[model samples]
Target: MDGQLLTYLFVGISFALYIGIAIWSRAGSTKEFYVAGGGVGPIANGMATAADWMSAASFISMAGIISFMGYDGSVFLMGWTGGYVLLALLLAPYLRKFGKFTVPDFIGDRYYSNTARSVAVFCALIISFTYVAGQMRGVGVVFSRFLEVEIDTGVYIGMIIVLFYAVLGGMKGITYTQVAQYCVLIFAFMVPAIFISIQMTGNPIPMFGMGDTMASNPEVNLLDRLDGLNAELGFDKYTEGSKSMIDVIAITLALMVGTAGLPHVIVRFFTVKRVKDARKSAGYALLFIAILYVTAPAVAVFSRVNLIETVSETDYKEMPAWFTNWEDLGLIGWTDKNADGKIQYLGDGPAMEGDGNKPAFDGVSKGVNGERVIVNPSNSVNELYVDQDIMVMANPEIADLPNWVIALVAAGCLAAALSTAAGLLLVISSSVSHDLIKKMIKPDISEKGELIAARLAAVGAVVIAGYFGINPPGFVAAVVALAFGLAAASFFPAIVLGIFHKRMNKEGAIAGMVVGMGLMLFYMLKFKFHLFGGGTSEDWWFGVSPEGFGAVAMFFNFLVSLVISRFTPAPPLEVQEIVENIRIPSGAGEATH
Candidate 1:
């Protein structure tokens, strides 16, 4: 069968499976909708959590970024994976022991104040919405490339599919559905890695192959060969750092704390049957996540090598079919300069070019025929542009893998995107329906009525998310980075203080959240959105990127909360008891339905 037909078949089959799971696991009560009735096994919950954590960004863009950044990219691998350790050890079990449906549920009751809950809900919405938009866009990118549809149409279709399952099954359906998604995405990611590893290093194991000698040139190790290519191309060394050590430390810390703080991730633990199960599930989740994380660097190296060998200095007119197809979709572009009819694959990446505001354009001069010269005697060839998000999805095509493998990749991309989007939609809906409406606005709402409200809220959330996907505010990386920062500043300090510090009061927690979140937002807007004339790195308080700004803001939150709580009245006696109870390992009980 043709590639398009194969893609349709694969995607169609995956959709059918998701819909079937939804039908079978339709939530019957508030408990089921909110936390799958708190009966999930550790292995199953872990797989679901992995699917929830590994969005389109992890599956699609991470390897691509790693391929380009080389050694500097290890920050993502360390930061994202390391954060789970924090989540498992510092947060997950304690929160699960608290036995609440939402993060705000714990905060509200722990502080004995609805005000604290409201602040938690606000933070949750910001973080969840920011993250969900990227997942929806991921779905669109895959569909647009594979199915030949417009991006807007792809998002609309994704929104419909999410609506079908997420609205009907809630957390119950999503959890089971994610189990299947994890299998599909992991398989899709590994197939190409195994193929490329064997092809390049003559070793089938990607992790081992990464350290093995190269098949093409046995004189040097694979990484050394990569370093040579990068140096020759004016790029950073493959195994050498590009960022300042301070910046790397800050970004990694932010990602770590932010992962622990993210409400969507924290809420996953509430679905488990016991406190021990929650901790066990975190270990399982890490194992599943690590499978992808460990293999990604190998994929990155292989793709980078393949791209250089296949395209560099080669005639553009004789380029492969995948190259033309991607170019037609505007993901990749090229204009030969110097009249050489060849592509220039060697150069510093986007961060090194231009005036830090515009794309780099090397040749704008006109030729004898009045045509723009794409290349000149200066060896300027700025005609090629490749979207980093396309790197992983396009890897199979780049390596000349089987068309059926390409189809499987398309299906896997959809699974990753849709699974994360569903999880976030659930978070948004619960914040609105459970925390905002039922808890505050209508305390006496019937269980059935509240269920209806939750489903309706989900529809609204998905609709808004779909619009963002159709018209993303910025690139995937920027928006996702913002999500982590918001979570880190707003949720992490508040929850940690509430659990560990008995003196923490509602006033201090609320004040700290507002200030920390507000500060991070102001900085991001000022620097990233040019809200204040595009503040340069020199103007940064500590040379922090907006993404890394969260860690700094989080520290301020901790300071403000700890210091201010000393001056305020201690939390109520009952609230102190609740905190003490959550910390204890014994007397673990089931969450009341």
Candidate 2:
């Protein structure tokens, strides 16, 4: 079959499978909708968690970031995976033992304050909605590129599919569907990576292939060749660090804590039955996630080498078909500056001579017919950096792979985006319905009414998220960074203090969250939005970029909470005993309230 046909076939089959699962596992009660009735097996929960965690950013954009950023990109790999360690060891088991339906439930009951819980719900909604918008945007990009449909049409189709299953089956349906998505996305990502690895380094395992000797010349190590290429192109080395030590450390810490604090990932643990299952599931989740994390750097190396080799030595007119196809997509373009019909990819700016050589078009202003054939136009400058998100999607075509593989990749990208979108939407809906409406404002509301409210809230969130996707304020990486910062500053400290420290009063917890979130937002907007009339990073406070500002905010939260708790009464004795009960697994089967 042709590639496009195969793409449609693969995507169609996958969607059918998801819809089937939704029908098979539709929620029957509030318990089923919220926690899948707490009947999930650890292995299945692990798979679903992996899918939920690896969003469009991971599938479509991470490798591309690594490809261009070189060693600096290791921050993402380490930050995201290391977060699971924190979640498994410090957060997951205790949260599961608390046996709550949603994250805000734990905050409300543990702190003994509706006010604290309401504040948490507000922060959760903001973080999840911001994060989901990016995922929906990714879905639109994939559909438009592969299905040959308009971006808006693709988004609408995706929205309907997600709304159908997510509303029908709730968390239970989403969990089963996510497991299948995990399989599809992982296979799609690794197959091309393995093929490219073998072609470049003769190593089947991409992780090992990244550091192995090159097939073209075994004498030179893979890292060494990459360093040489980067130096030739006025870029940093692949193995050496470029960013300041402090920035790297701060950003990595922020991402790790933020990942642990994300409500959607935390809530997944509530679906499993036992505290032990939650711990075991975290280990499994990390293992499943590591497959792609390890393979990503290898893809980066292979694709970067291939791109340079294809473009560096060839004349612009002789560039490969993949180049032209991407150019048609507005991803790649070229100009014949000097009318010499030769495209130059060099270190110095365009129109500069090669060492003392004159411009490539200095003497060839007009063509042989004497018509005006200006070789170097006024704005014909070659930029070395291409958008990072394009690297993974464009990799298959760059390697001359079959069309079906390209289409399958497109489907995989959508799967990644949709799975995460569904999870984030659930978080938004649950915070509004379960936390705000049921617990705070309408304590006497019926279960059926809450469910209806939840569905309506989900629809509203989808509309807002769709708008952000269409007009994304920044690139994928930048948006994710902001999300991480917000989550870290607001949620991580609150949850950790609520769980591990019984003395943390509602007053302290609420105050800490408000202060943390406020400070982080201020710093982010100050650097990112030029709010308060502050200059860029060059004039930032202590040179902290918006990306690394979360660490500072989190620390301030901790310090204020500790100081405030000392001066305030601890949570009520009943709440203190409840915390004690949550610390053990024996009473987890019993309801605390």
Best by lDDT: 1
For residue 11, what is the lDDT in candidate 1? 94
Model 1 lDDT per residue over 1-593, tens place: 89999999999999999999999999998889989888999999999999999988799878877887788788888888999999999988888787776888888887788998998898888889989888888888898999889889999999999999999999999999999999999999999889889888999999889989988888889888888887887767888897878888888888899999888888889888889889899999999999999999998888888877777777776788888677655566565556677777657445322212323234344334332233312234444556677888888999899999999999989999999999999999999989988889999998898899999999999999999999766556557767888888888999898878889999899889988998988888898777967788778778888878999999999998888888999888888898888898864666652
TM-score of each: 0.95, 0.92
lDDT values of the candidates? 0.84, 0.79
Candidate 2 lDDT over residue span 1-593, tens digit each: 78879889889988998899999999876677777778898999999999999998888878877887789888888888888788888998888888776777888888888998988898898788768877877877777777778777788888888888888888899999999999989999998988888888899998899899999899988888988987886666778887777888888888899898889999899888778788888999999999989888888888888777777646666666667555443334345445455554544442221111112233324443232233333343442224456778889888888787787787788889889998988888888888888888999999899888888888877887787777655556666767888889988888898887889998898888999999998887777767788665578665666877887889888888888999998788888887877777663562121
lDDT at position 292, candidate 2: 89
